[model samples]
Target: MENYPKSINASSLNDWYNSEKEDPVLIDVREHSELEIACFPKEFLHIPISKVTSTYVEELFAGLFEREIVVACHAGIRSYNFCQWSLDNNIVSEIWNLEEGIDGWSRYIDPSIPRY
Candidate 1:
């Protein structure tokens, strides 16, 4: 099994997207304004960090039901914190955070995506 707190880089994430027959849930934890300025692949679900608390995260995650989840933020600090929280709360799910956020992705993988 892969590491529980595994962190994936942009290429790794793209490769996972390419190889997985059924895509996992891609979650962006950025704010709405940030999303308006830039967004990830259309397949992802956007859940702002303001709504990621234990009280409301379940609502955000409703219907996902044990599926693998990839959480991202500006530079992954938020996502990493969220992953740690999920583990602590025993909300067992395969969770990964993009290691460098969209900035790293744009720098190393796809320049077409803007950096904010």
Candidate 2:
């Protein structure tokens, strides 16, 4: 598979969902306070950006090196940054950022969810 950190948009994500038969890793990188403002899929794993240091991030993803990871954040900036970092650091994982993030999600995708 191609390196995932470069970028991945929402529309492409829909295709990925359609094409991929298995459940990929979904990681939420937002802060706790931000999460209070908006929530993601219940299946998502919380590994806040605050804890994305060399130690913590490595520890958090310790056993999931081979998983396909989709990194999400409030607006997608942090998740994009993390994707780049992960790629640069030689962590072998696929990462996709939800373009527009929860804001876009609330605005265009699903309105039932509250927006911050």
Candidate 3:
């Protein structure tokens, strides 16, 4: 099994995105309605936590196992749970949870990303 990072703070994520040669996929697990309140850059893939079901996982995320995935939610709880489940189910080995979630991102990296 591949050893994956468990979590990443917003500032480090910001720095990684800015300087890293390989672009990591940022997956937002917040609901569609929650997105209207605050949103990250367009580069983030909006895949609500609810949609990560078995069928959806098989259909949409099967090929993402080898990719670097950073999952984010409002306060990090949901994303953390998702990443844990993904790891347990062998969905993705390179998955990481955004420490403190978008709320942290708003406070540490970009204040423009509203906090709810």
Computed on alpha carbons, the lDDT of every model, listed in order, comes to: 0.77, 0.74, 0.82
lDDT of 3 by residue, 1-116 (tens): 54545889998888888885676788899999999999987488888887788667656676665677889999999998888877777676658899989899999988988889
Q: In candidate 3, what residue range of length 10 has the lowest lDDT sum? A: 57-66
Candidate numbers sorted by TM-score from highest down:
3, 1, 2
Worst 10 residues of 1 by lDDT: 86-95
Query: For residues 1-116, what per-residue lDDT tens digits would candidate 1 score against the true structure?
Result: 43356699988888877894667788888899988776775478887888777867777677777677888888889888777777676565557888988777777777887887
Query: What is the Cα-based lDDT of residue 106 in candidate 2?
Result: 72
Better of 1 and 3 by lDDT: 3
Give candidate 2's error at residue 85 in angstroms. 1.0
Q: Give the clashing residue pairs of candidate 3, or none.
A: none
Compared with the true structure, what per-residue lDDT tens digits does model 2 show for residues 17-116? Answer: 6684666677888889888878864478888887777777777788887777888887788888888788767665566677777776677666777887
* Candidate No. with top lDDT: 3
